[model samples]
Target: MRVPILRQGPYLIASIQAAVTDEDLLHLGQEVVERVGQYRSRGVILDVTVLDVMDSFAARTLRDLARAVRLRGAETVIVGIQPEVAFSMVRLGLSLEGVGTALDLEDGLALLDQHVRRRGKGGR
Candidate 1:
């Protein structure tokens, strides 16, 4: 599907749309991780505002991807989650506990910048 991953300074940004299948997400995970390492990104912000229905598989994939990215020494942030989608995810019992979220892309990028700076200062 070639989800465009833009390199913005030390961060990677992606805007996901349309219906994402399991295979597509898997490839995306791999590609993202590779890019993270290749670019040595400090953080990533993925905009999921256009996703109307986030199924369990997709939610799980996102959570797992975030964790994987962290293991690669990069922070992950999810932005633009609609209220109904958030409620639906909760209702479906898929608690995105460890996943970082923001009200919008700007907030996500700002939050990620802060996280990266804090981590850099903390050296952890």
Candidate 2:
């Protein structure tokens, strides 16, 4: 089941709690986009802790979700990618460049909080 980890002020945190199939990945992307719209949030922290594998579809979906968040005047940060998965992404030349990433959930929230503070300082 998809679980939202936190909701603080204008920031929301969500978890992708399973090995996502291609179809599920697409649905997840859509759901994130929709949630961003529904919440009118400023940022999102996506906890991918339960995801052990990252395929092309998952990567693409995440990229799409980031784009969608931006279009909704929000930002997306991905977290909890295992070291091995990070290595694989680097080896595959996957570009999560514009998308923020954190080693763990706490770091992800801290990053998001920082971004929010920065944006509040007229960085938007």
- Evaluated at residue 79, the lDDT of candidate 1 is 93
The list of candidate 1 runs beyond 4 A from truth reads none
Off by over 4 Å in 2: 1-8
- TM-score per model over all chains: 0.95, 0.86
lDDT of 2 at 19: 52
Q: Candidate 2, overall lDDT?
A: 0.79
lDDT per residue, candidate 1, 27-53, as tens digits? 888888899999989898888999987
Span of 10 residues, lowest total lDDT, candidate 1: 17-26
lDDT of each: 0.88, 0.79
Instruction: For candidate 1, list the clashing residue pairs, or say none.
Output: none
